[model samples]
Target: MALTRQVISTLQDNGTDIMGPDVMAYHYPDASIISGSLLTVEANHFAVLKSRGAVLGVYDTGQYPIQTPDKPLLGGFVTGFFGGNSPWQYEVLYVNRAKLLVRASGVATSAEMAEMVYQVDYYIHVDSKDDALKLTTHMPFSGHYIKADEVASYAAPVVEQAINQVVQVTPMEKINEHIHEVVELLKEHMSAFLSVFGITLNDAKVLILPKDDRMRELISLRAFGLSELDAVRYYTALKMAERGLVSAPNMAVGAPFSIGGATMGTYPVPDGHASVTLPKG
Candidate 1:
């Protein structure tokens, strides 16, 4: 009678990285193989097979029969000579083609202000599968994890350097006002830095807020969608109001009001009539 046997279940596959961000080095567990057992390796992935301590072959993107007859002459000879019915042990490992996400966000300091404290947020991912495998080989890992931060660490120093270079030379006046310009400058260096590890930055953003509450209020005055000159005019109006040079809201109609800096003089009164008008603040 014909009978069927199984190695690994088809249900074992899921998109989750077998080696997560915290776990780096791992190989698939050994499994028993029979003549017609299933061996399926998905597309855009690598399945490295090994016997004993030596790699037998790297397979990808195909279904295959794992039969004794399919084995090389030397391998078959060794198996036959080893004696009775010892289970054939094989190591099959996988590497992925999917991109991995990396994010870095923090306040970077500049020599200009002990630290010109500004915030930055960046999103990035590994650009190449080949490079990621090489990274896995080079990094230290005891079992299954390497830190997510360790994978993206190549970009952090670049970010700091970019911030330092751009912020140090920038005039203190424009540093907080034109942060987008600083981010653009940083991108030039970051692009090259990320390329080394086959990584790419995506939809990254930068924001600079005033550390002082007073300065923040000064900035919020532009909420009216005003042009720069209009903002200046609005600001001047606020200052005038604060100084009491502007009139009170309940002032009588047609009453004359003089601004604090204005030169006021009494006009010679006409004999027939007296006239008065409200003054603009």
Candidate 2:
């Protein structure tokens, strides 16, 4: 003879969009849901029912009655019940389908061997049922909710790796000048990398900066009447001379620098004797 069982008549999410921008997934408190229970899923959300790590079904923005005919998993009954509860056991996880902003920062080495700090602001979202399943399956969250910072934490290393790849081939002096190009490449690489986790990269903004203040000052010379080419040539010569790659006499005022077999014209240095006048700061 079959014993009596307790049934949860209704399962609903009252705190729908209230999850806000920080939350990614919300875990339903009850895992013992029986057939014929009404599951209310809010808009812009996915209600995923799972049994022992297996996804039984994904419901979007509607009320669903947990019936055995529709879901075969609901047919199996868990026996040896102490309390008058149904043998069926399942967990429902609500995934937020909204686009979320995630920010990540890291340090990368430039082609010039300069340590550059980088930050990326990106937008991501889980669009389909498959995306929601992958997210719930792969990214396990503790407690009741998974937050955006958790996603940011996972993205930080990936973003850094992508930034390193871009900057490692780009010289420090020209990094800022080609920042848009860098951002595009980062978006491309990061999009592919994040796709594995069921997240889509909508857009991203990347900012790269030299780790040293002196390097920043050197690159800023372009704002003070110096051309981009002249700024690179000037900073290159200074770095080379500092490293003893160029002789002291070759660094004198009006002395040209021969870099990569090409002659670069003189750069005026502030040593109490220079022809070009610079704006006083």
Q: Candidates' TM-scores?
A: 0.49, 0.68
lDDT comparing candidate 1 with the true structure: 0.52
**TM-score of decoy 1:** 0.49
- List ranges where model 1 is wrong by over 4 Å: 1-96, 110-129, 171-173, 176-181, 200-203, 210-281
Q: What's the lDDT for all of these models? A: 0.52, 0.73
Point to the candidate with the largest TM-score.
2
Measured with C-alpha atoms, the lDDT of residue 116 in candidate 1 is: 45
Residue lDDT tens for model 1, 1-281: 12245554222457444554333224555454445666665554455555554555555567766654423333445457643233456655554444445555445444346344555566555445455444444454434334456544656777767776766666444666567677887777777766564456564566655455544454566555665555555664565467785443213122344656563322335674653333343
Candidate 2 wrongly placed segments (more than 4 Å): 1-18, 68-80, 227-281
* Residue-level lDDT for 242 in candidate 1: 76
Quote the lDDT for 139 in model 2: 90
Q: Which window of ten consecutive residues has the lowest lDDT sum in model 1? A: 247-256
